[model samples]
Target: MTMKILISDPNKCNGCRMCRTACAIRKAGVCNPEKSRIQVIQMDECDRYLPLVCQNCEDAPCIAACPKEAISRMDDPVLQTVIDYNKCVGCKMCLNACSFGAIGFDEDRGRPFKCDLCGGDPLCVHFCEPGALTLKDSAMIQYDQARTSALRRTVGIRR
Candidate 1:
């Protein structure tokens, strides 16, 4: 089985954003959501908060979209996708390819960063007290996603 995968419960999420803060601290050594691998988007009209993170897709398009060969995934005991910033040209191609908008910019290095799942122990899960975020099985996540998709249709922009 794949490693623990991050899941977001939009119904329980109120856009509190403690997950983002925790992620930022764990990854960046400071509290900066801009540098955090995980991000949250708040929809006031819909009264929802959407947490975005790297999905570690089996067929990750971001890996293919990177012309510099900067993005790649390891298929060993744990499935992990890593980005070589030294090789990344910051073309934002991966950003465009990611459907979840999980990719974020690093102003200091001029490179793109994304969730590496805190090296397997996600701090976001520890910080999310309301149970809005948790690490779940990949298979269960897929089933939940399929059901969620069938529940509603995308009417506006695909992005």
Candidate 2:
């Protein structure tokens, strides 16, 4: 089986924000949407709801941007980018480096947080009742990106 990456279908999202609630509870032991690693962006005027999470890029900018070397991929087979809380010094460089705006800040911890795929079984995916979030083969990411770009063009949404 190929390694999987998290993907989202904005068209399928109903903006219920159940994914956010799931992520927050799993990661932070709380029910705060603000603490959630996955964020639901509501474009009310356009009537679009996008669930944004870390892409876990092969060449992740966050890894390069971290001065403390706090961000790095997991050991073999898991390949997910994770933050080392012990090494993180509250620097927000990773937040700025993420083009997708997937990295989130925890004001209480003063550290950046992002989706780590919940150790390969994401709670967000489990709780996505609309089926907006799913794990796809890593090879399909390029196709998904192209589809997103085309959709944006058709909808007049600029990156």
Q: What is the lDDT of residue 123 in candidate 1?
A: 89
Lowest summed-lDDT stretch of 10 residues in model 1? Answer: 150-159
Which residue pairs clash within candidate 2? none
Instruction: Provide backbone clash counts, one per model.
Output: 0, 0
TM-score of 2: 0.80
Across 39-148, the per-residue lDDT of candidate 1 in tens digits comes to 88886788798888987887899999999999988774244778887899989899999988988888787889888777667888888888988877677878887767
Local accuracy of candidate 2 as per-residue lDDT tens digits, 1-159: 356778888899999999999999999999999899898888687768999988778899999999999999865334578889999998899999999899999998798888778877889999999899998776687787899999999999999
Once superposed on the true structure, which residue ranges of model 2 sit more than 4 Å away at CA?
A: 75-79, 139-159
* Candidate 1 wrong stretches, greater than 4 Å: 77-79, 139-159
Q: Write down the lDDT of every candidate, Cα atoms only.
A: 0.82, 0.88
